[model samples]
Target: MKKIRKKAFEPIDKEEKELMESIERDEWRPVKNIDQEKKKAMAAARNTLRKDKRINLRLTQKDYHQIQIKAIEEGIPYQTLISSIVHKYLNGSLTPRS
Candidate 1:
């Protein structure tokens, strides 16, 4: 058993004070079945991933090098950059001015 100290006055912000008051009043409680809820969320995410399709494409050396450099600057794999560009173009959101 741990012994807690009671203070006459302690300065805390509104959110912290509210949280402490709720804890002191036993207003907070744990979920009855947390594992089941987490499993459901994981299953939903897996289902979304499973719907994705894979594709392969051949590119010229110049185009591939440019794509690789651009992908490096964007901090993503070249394949992922290509996928994002294709997706954006298909959705009519990627507009090339030049």
Candidate 2:
């Protein structure tokens, strides 16, 4: 069998090398200003507050299965159905049909 020769790998060109060096240097810079960091922290805190204010509720297995079946029939997730129900109730648009 004849021996196969491998080609030598070539180094990157000058412009490519300089571009890589610039990227490496810029990577060490601070990602955001102090004011931007503060604003981000405040936004995160507000989100946490909003999430924490929610109440946790429990449902019987039979009720949950019924809701899941209705959600499947409606082509929506059970959580979406719960959210719609809550929204309608809060908005005073939920009414029992005669």
Candidate 3:
């Protein structure tokens, strides 16, 4: 005899399965009538400007001044330089020298 059981939460549910089937059948449609060419261009522009998220930063006056000097030398904004350094460090591209 086969065991019949029901778990509180199935790994997958019926609605999810139905949605997957619909997607596989290409029956899914966008809720909004977005223009392909125009929306695609706008999407690309939005992605390029995805740095829209902002955060508060705290720095000592001396460090801030030093960073400003470096930014001036690099011909970029201080905030941009700081963001780049943070990004590199987080991605493991920047390392502390021994």
Candidate 4:
């Protein structure tokens, strides 16, 4: 015997509604090799996080001190904080102060 499952509620937003409709239409496909796909994804993530290069950056005394203070407050190294700032700015996720 087959059991029928009921949807609890309607999608709340356009993206959610579209996703639900797509699922109903069977537009999504399952990955063929789950293990292989998982390995590839893990490798890609490791490569993304690998920091393989170093460069010299000269900062003024005041600016460097402030960055160190912020890093300490965040409980991360100042270099990591600087790297994060650069990454966020490059990805358009960091906004400039008006």
Ten-residue region with minimum lDDT total, candidate 3: 3-12
For each candidate in the order shown, give its overall lDDT on alpha carbons.
0.88, 0.79, 0.85, 0.97
Per-candidate RMSD vs. true structure?
9.3, 15.2, 12.4, 4.2
Judging by TM-score, tell me the better candidate of 1 and 4: 4
TM-score of each: 0.47, 0.42, 0.50, 0.73
lDDT of 4 at 67: 100
| Candidate 2 residue spans exceeding 4 A from truth | 1-55, 96-98
Whole-model lDDT for model 2 versus the true structure? 0.79
Q: Which residue pairs collide, candidate 3?
A: none
- lDDT winner: 4
Candidate 4 lDDT over 1-98, as tens digits, reads 89897888989999999999899899999999999999999999999999998989999999999999999999999999999999999999998998
What tens digits encode model 2's per-residue C-alpha lDDT throughout 2-98? 9885535433798866766676578556655889999999999988556334567799999999999999999999887987898788788997677
| C-alpha root-mean-square deviation, candidate 2 | 15.2
Model 3: CA > 4 A from native: 1-49
lDDT of 1 by residue, 6-89 (tens): 966774798888888888899988878999989998999999567378777989999999999999999999988998898788
Lowest summed lDDT window (length 10), candidate 2: 48-57
What overall lDDT, based on C-alpha atoms, would model 4 receive against the true structure?
A: 0.97
